[model samples]
Target: MTSYTLGQKYISPTKPERGVFPLDHEGECKETMLKYMLCLSRNDNKPSLCQAESKDYFQCRMDRNLMKKHEWEDLGYSNEQQRKT
Candidate 1:
């Protein structure tokens, strides 16, 4: 399996490289990817979405794209304002 070593640590999922080297490995699966993306900084030392939820919260929601309500909330827009813009 292809693996990436970030410094001394190994990157999981053994995903395909840019331009599609291979897609056999799936360690960095959709769920892992979403979790990483959603982890975009909340604040300085502030709790992130992962920090606040139940351990299995994301475990169940993994791989699903962020919903409209969440996307709007993240953009600092309400449902009404987001639809208008």
Candidate 2:
């Protein structure tokens, strides 16, 4: 028999088209995601080590108009990385 869950089943989000931003974009920002992949490879494939890279990658996406605008602040972290000076 199958067991029922209280919440919605964990369905993976839709990925961008294969030849789209971050996937087919050019320039240094494109490497952000690559950096994450490298980190993951070195860190026993752990997903956490690549978070920073993922953030950069997403920021790049927004900057390039690949994703919707005005969503960076929400998607970006609390800006704790920013310095007061």
Best prediction by TM-score: 2
Deviating ranges (above 4 Å) for candidate 2: 1-28, 70-85
Deviating ranges (above 4 Å) for candidate 1: 1-29, 45-49, 52-54, 57-85
- The Cα RMSD of model 1 versus the native structure comes to 15.2
TM-score of each: 0.19, 0.48
Q: Residue by residue across 1-85, what tens digits does model 2's lDDT show?
A: 9987878778888977533544444564657767878888989998655667767777777777676654434654455533321
Q: Candidate 1, residues 2-64: lDDT per residue as tens digits?
A: 886767965588755433432324444455545544653543434333343222233333333
Find the 10 residues in a row with the least total lDDT in model 1: 61-70
Assess each prediction's global lDDT (C-alpha) against the native. 0.40, 0.64
Return model 2's CA RMSD, one decimal. 10.7
